[model samples]
Target: MEKTFKFTPEEFRTSVKIIQYLRTAIGSSLENHDEQKVRKYIHQAIVAGHVHRDVFGLNPILTSLQTAQIAVDEIGLHRDGVIATLLYGSVANDDDHEEIDQLFGENVARIVMGLAKIQKLYEKNPVIESENFRNLLLSFAEDMRVILIMIADRVNIMRQIRDVEQEEARHEVSEEASYLYAPLAHKLGLYGLKSELEDLSLKYLEHDAYYMIKEDLNATKKSRDAYIQQFIAPIQEKLTEAGLKFHMKGRTKSIHSIWQKMKKQKCGFKGIYDLFAIRIIIDSPYNLEKQLCWQAYSIVTDMYQPNPKRLRDWLSVPKSNGYESLHITVLGPESKWVEVQIRTERMDDIAEHGLAAHWRYKGIKSGGQMDEWLANIRAALEAGDNMEVMDNFKMTLAPEEMFVFTPKGDLFKFPAGATVLDFAYRIHSKIGNTCVGGRVNGKVVPMRQELHSGDSVEILTQSNQTPKHAWLSIVTTAKARAKIRLALKETQVKDGLYAKELLERRFKNKKIEIEESIMGHLVKKMGFKEVSDFYKQVSDGKLDPNDIIDKYVEIRNYQENHAKEHEARSAEEFEYEGPVEDLSSQSDDVLTIDQNLKGIDYHLASCCHPIYGDKIFGFVTAGGGIKIHRTDCPNAPEMRRRFGYRIVRARWSGKGTSQYSTTLKVIGNDDIGIISNITSIISKEEKILMRSINIDSHDGLFSGNLVVQLEDTTRLQALIKKLKMVKGVKQVQRI
Candidate 1:
């Protein structure tokens, strides 16, 4: 029987009971505030057991009740915010132990579900970035409300983070908050929350650094406080004299942000902008706020020389998060860059509250769209390998970007350094796979060249041209990477698979065992995905057989002994055995690594990883014994299967270097540039050598024969499902 979640009688009662306490506190917290919706949201928490997952043992009654009261006293009730507070971390997945459906009204429960979905802005996927990005876009396209609720929930949670964990855990949470949540809050226009979150998160992400800065700030607090008072006096007096109802104040940059500036700009604290900014919040009709903003700008400019380029007009086109403010960086007293932001009280609320603040005014009905991108994020767990993780990373992280149009007027938004291949994939996968070249802003550029803001891009394609082996070096986006790799793998498998069919077709007449072992050994030597890869390469006029068998046999024995020796080593030794940047078992070979060869002395022969049940052979070659094909490799079959067959059988002699090679062929239905994926697997397997590969397709069919080099067949066969999963690829086999 499957295990299910259940709440103890007391826990269920306490989680929901906090609502009455919160409602009671709100009556005193605000001036004539409405509380029906706020109460409803609080009641939903018990129904949604958020703590049942990752954390436990907190006093739910005391914590929830106290937190709710604090929320009422401090933030008041923007019904949506209140609802989000109750449902924060409420999803049934991850650490969530309860279901909202059990205790809340459907409307409240649904919104809570949506809030839980938008949590991936923090998770990292170093590969498969495009899928993550695609999910983000689709989520936003589906609903903006999900993002709003999530942003609101995080801002509120950070407020109480101190109550949630041990010292180390608190710091970890804060660091995450600083890096991801704080920026998100800033983007959403939650100014008060954004500032506090940034400061608080810093206290956790880097404790020593955070405390050092705090101590320094404290040391100079007396003098700095006096300086702020004097600076704000003139601005206040001028605004008062002008009869404009205004508030002037000083501001300091976030600690982390200041540290980043110091590091990047290579400047001392004294060199950085030290003035507390003056904000003029006036009481005016919404319509009058614009005129007041201009008037303030003029007054400020009159007092100081305003930098022409350091001006922003968000009022005209509000940010996606609903933030709007007029900003100007002026040349102030002592020629300093003093930034001033002017806005009305209402605008201030929207900016500081972000989507949550918007929901307070707009109501859930207005903000009721579903966030599909968040749903896609929820689906991210399906990508089980490094390849998939990397793919997801490239897709989702361009939050502050614009998708402008090119001369022909096509549009796609890219992060600051997107390249031509990124542009091609943005247009369409087909365009990217067949892309031969590109034009950026009407000038021909190498496909790998970086794209700049305002540059229009055009792609070039070839009908017969498939994605090349060199394309991965140039493609910057995960979508492009995944597509190219998939296509290549499909092509390699097909070539070898077809070759396998042909060999079997020929061997049927000879009445000889087209031994799976022999065929595997042969294909492995040539670095084909399957036996078909060898046949197809031979038939296609791209491969030779000699030298493959000898190398295949030599490598097979080396690997067996290595595995045995490795298993005998202690676990501690196993943990620290290799490179630090990547930890895969075959970090050097399994997944392609970032390596600049000091000198190419070693060769991972493309041959059969001669296992115990197989007939093996060895061959001598120039440069090195690099080509390890099967003893019965078709091209080498006549030599081994006939005349020199006896010499091919070599037993386990002395234990040389535990190095070996095997090849694979991934053949399936034709796909555009199927060879890319095949080769990518070799690249990802970094240990595997890709000696040679070929591609061909016609009439809705695609075939790729790839030669993937590996230490042994164990690592080689890892590609079967991966290749089979590629779209349009019909089959995969060992070569």
Candidate 2:
């Protein structure tokens, strides 16, 4: 007999009570059908007791329900977010994405999937400090609500894990809460949750310090209350006499913050002053909130002299994370300075709930600052360096914006320390490409000069200026760096092409045919990674063509001698003369084109000479047989446009079965021994055979057509690249 665990009658009742609570809480927010669906899932999760139990043996269903409640009441999420939180465990454990989408909608499915991915990420127990690890974590969270729900869920878990026996796991969770999630919450403007997370983490990780502070706060509770009441009595009377409707409270700083202050100031908890701040929340209409806040600021400053340096006026300009308030430090009744924060009801809500309240007040679907931040995330991911993405993400999380202006006085906001080049790219990529420098406040400055707040900037552009690889190091913004990298890559490709053409022209002039294998060995021995990199160096005039040719010849001779020695040994070991079958042309399988149709009568098109592994498509010829042409064939666009109905999608089914015939046109200076040099290279190549050569010589120029046979495009491209490296070859092209 096997033992089993089932929910007790009391546990089942507890779950039902939670469900009723959720029903009342979510009553008007969700449609009747949606509410029923959510309850149905909750009921199922409760009955499936095993699904709720973790290694700690806690009540799983209750945990999820409590998490959902936090998401609703604390995080201000509505139906879809609530539903995803309720079903996260079930969806993560089961592979029923279609069922989730069909029942709830695609949004719910996506959020659940993101949650599942993050759960998997946590299960790996990755090193928390790794940047790539953090990047992957953010990338997995495709939707912002996923992050919010996870934060809420983490808070619920933190609340419940205080008594768990697994001390090590508890400590790890607490450390993670401090390291990743708390900062995330703070970045999102959820100061309340941020403080809660930090306090709980400290309680678990620094038990002695946490309790010490807690006991001290408890001991000082009576005096603190008296002091707060005495301090606010006069201010409340003044505001009331001024005909303002408002409420005031003394907000204590978190235990973690107090501990931090003690460590920084090298003092005891009692020695730290300003442990609590008086927050005055005003009940004012939207238009008058700022005015009333200023009035309150003036009244308080008049009543008690305020420290001008300690005044913070965020009401004039809200933070990038949507935090707005007015803070002042004033001399109080006992000559002790106290911090006071004043804000309207709306501002207070945003300050308390972070982006959730901001989203609600602004209409959830509207494109606001948060949406722009999301777009920046997408762009950073596209830049393709995971570490860079993580850096940009961390910067954006708690971004401090500094305002700058264009020559025309158009205002722009950039992260602190942003450069003039960053501004140029933000204006337009074309401007960035041509930016020579900038004029900051009527003074010409280098492009890398950091812009100060309120500095007027005018970009200087020159047509001949282009993006250099060095620009990558100069720009601070991710957008500028990504665009500069793209421009440099494009320029490198064009330069490589030009160098290859010049090398081939030189090879044709020398009349030396090159061997790709020998040249590849030579390039590697010279410390190059790829042949194109070698070409780039050649375009930069870093290597002479004559020296490269000499090296190629030396390597070729050495390889030939090594091969002869092996052949001689093999011939002496086993001497059996027999006719060998030529199986090279044997076909492996017919091409499996698109549309699942096979065995079609088709041949490789001569116009493009497409080989195995080439991107291809089928064209019905006038003879009714299909012709396979490379997608990049010069004639493809014209054919597709002229005979749209005759074109069909196609691709190579497998590796090439046999060799292909191709033609190369060579042009060079009419120089002595050039033809011999070219013919010598072709005859020495083991895999390539020259079928024919037709030459025409005119004044100062030699042009020739050479036909060769090789297995596939890979070999054909190698052959062309080799021919391009000859000393006098000016041009090489496949015909």
Candidate 3:
């Protein structure tokens, strides 16, 4: 029996301040049916030591709880989310789903379960592809609150990473956070989280560089702060005089971002100026938000000499991630560069919290732009196989974006370096599959032509045109690659089916029955893993049907002659003493040598040499007593159709001791000593006895036929391998 501890009503009432703060932070949409119970859960979590002690030696439960609170609270999620955040780690560890369900309800339990699955996924496959990561996230798309929780958890981990002891673990965690989690945050419109994650990752990954930037910023903080105050003073006075309600604040650049600028500009810390940005948050009416942002932008530029080329008018057209801010870099006091941002309070919140803030402040439905973006991501993931999905994921995660247009004025966004084929596939898979080439801005361009922003693309398609293998290398988008591979595979399957039909017709004409065993041998002889591959080659005209038929005929003749000679010699020593057993029944059962027919010798036919494992039938020839032929022999159909009365059932009694003769064709470059090399290899194999060799040379290529004797198909295959390794040899195949 386990003791269950619970929080009392008095204990919950004492935490009213915390609950009220959460309620206000989360907005009016939040609801708590029993605030007492929610508070009690938090209290229990703290008492269980889940809040105070560090979970992963980086962040304590309290820190994660706060981060989760900020995440849900900013998004205006319901009260269950708040309770789950506090007890997520505790419930996860104790497997206390029943308690959570009974107290906080099933929704809270489900969210915690999703979080546990996410943690497990990350732990088991740390190096998972972006597509797989997206797929995992989308699995919980029905309840997107889980993803929000994960993002919050990641943010808290990065914030408290400094407390982590092992340098190696910190480096790994930071790299994953930077490369994987940061891009995800950015994609989700969590710009603040993205920037923070990037900065924290850079802090540990590039410690020396981080500290240098930090030390430089601190050393110049006094002068920087004074300069910012001087620059904002006039703008602040004018905005107030204009009756606009606003608050101006100075923000220093994050160390991670500062380092990025230094690297991108190829300069030292002193050479890099504008280490801070001044943000003006205006409190405007709902309808006047955009107008107030522009007004502030004008007031700020009027106070300083603004750089026209450095201005970003994102307020006019919000970024894809819903970021709305007007940025301008100006020459400030002391001739130093300074960046200023102008946005309304709503815009400011959206900028800080990204998608969550966008939804909460804008009052947009869940199925709007955010859903559309997620659908696109899901489409990309579903479009390709695992490897291709990963490639697409990386492409999607790329920060640099370009906007291209179709002939109909439809706008499309793609990563940098995406080509015309990628554009076609992005439009539709069918369009990409049939695309021959395209015109870019009224000029004919190859499908591989890299598109630029604002270019009008017109895809030129043909009905007969299908995706080519080379198109895979040309297209950069995951969707294009996946569609191309699928089309190619379909084509291969179609060709294989046609080849199979063609082979069947050829065998029928040659009076032979096609069998799986016969096709297996042919596939092995042609160096194919499966019969379908051989069929594809045949359908593509790479192999000759006549050559295959002739080889089968040759094998049948050899077996027939050998069987005739044995039957004649055995007849001299033995005489039948009883009625003959039913050959059909004897063939179906385990075959054994008949003592009564000891004198009447019979052997495997030369024409269709029946191996120990082969399905066979015996034919009594005019001179030979009986000849064994494989059921799928080239002559079996003719024998069965015409001389049906003469055919007798046959089966192999035991393994033969004698070697079997097989013919091999070797093709190679007509190099000097190439024939000698082939002969040398065959001679080296002690078990392989060479019967004859014939070589034909034409132009720069040579083809040779070598007849060799081996004990079994295994030895023959081994000999073929040895022959294939000879210098200048292109192919070695049993005919």
Query: What local lDDT does model 2 show for residue 720?
Result: 79
Candidates' TM-scores? 0.44, 0.52, 0.48
**Model 2: per-residue lDDT, tens digit, 1-735?**
113436678777877887788778767656558867765765665455425467666666677778888877776666667788878875535465787888887767777887886675554345554433343444446565688888888898899898999999889889888888897788678888899999999999999999999999999999999999999999999999999999999998899999999999999997899899999999998878889999999889989999999999888777767788999999998899999999999989989987657644532222456545744443433332233443444323333556566665455667788999999999999999999999987899999999865566899999988898888888888989999989988878987898878777777788877766566788899998887789888988998988887777788788666544433221112222222444335556467767699898888888877767678899999999999888999999999889999999886665665656678998865653455557778878866777767777666567888877666778878877877877557798987
Per-candidate clash tally: 91, 25, 20
Candidate 3, 420-488: lDDT as tens digits: 999999899889889988998789998999986546689999999877788889988777789889989
Worst 10 residues of 2 by lDDT: 570-579
Q: Could you tell me how far off, in angstroms, the CA of residue 250 lies in candidate 1 after the best superposition?
A: 1.9
List the RMSD of every prediction in angstroms: 27.4, 28.8, 26.4
lDDT of 1 by residue, 1-735 (tens): 113335567756865666666556444433233355334443454355434433423443334344444444333433333444455543445333234444433334544555554343223221212333333433332233344444444454555565665776666556556655556556545567667777777665666777776677677778776766765577777877888987766666667667666678897666567425667787777667789888877887887788889899977765555566898887755555777889888777666554334434321121111222222222332221122432342223344453433445434566656788878877877888777778775689877878754455678788876776677877767777888888777767766676556655555654544434444665665567755546656655565333443444455556445445433332212111222332122313221112322222232233444422234444434444323335555556655555452322232332222334333455544433344444454567655555545555555454555544344444555656666655346677666
Error in Å for residue 566 of model 1 = 77
Q: What C-alpha lDDT, on a 0 to 100 scale, does residue 192 get in candidate 2?
A: 88
Off by over 4 Å in 3: 1-64, 72-76, 92-103, 128-135, 138-141, 333-335, 359-368, 371-735
**Global lDDT scores for all candidate models:** 0.53, 0.77, 0.68
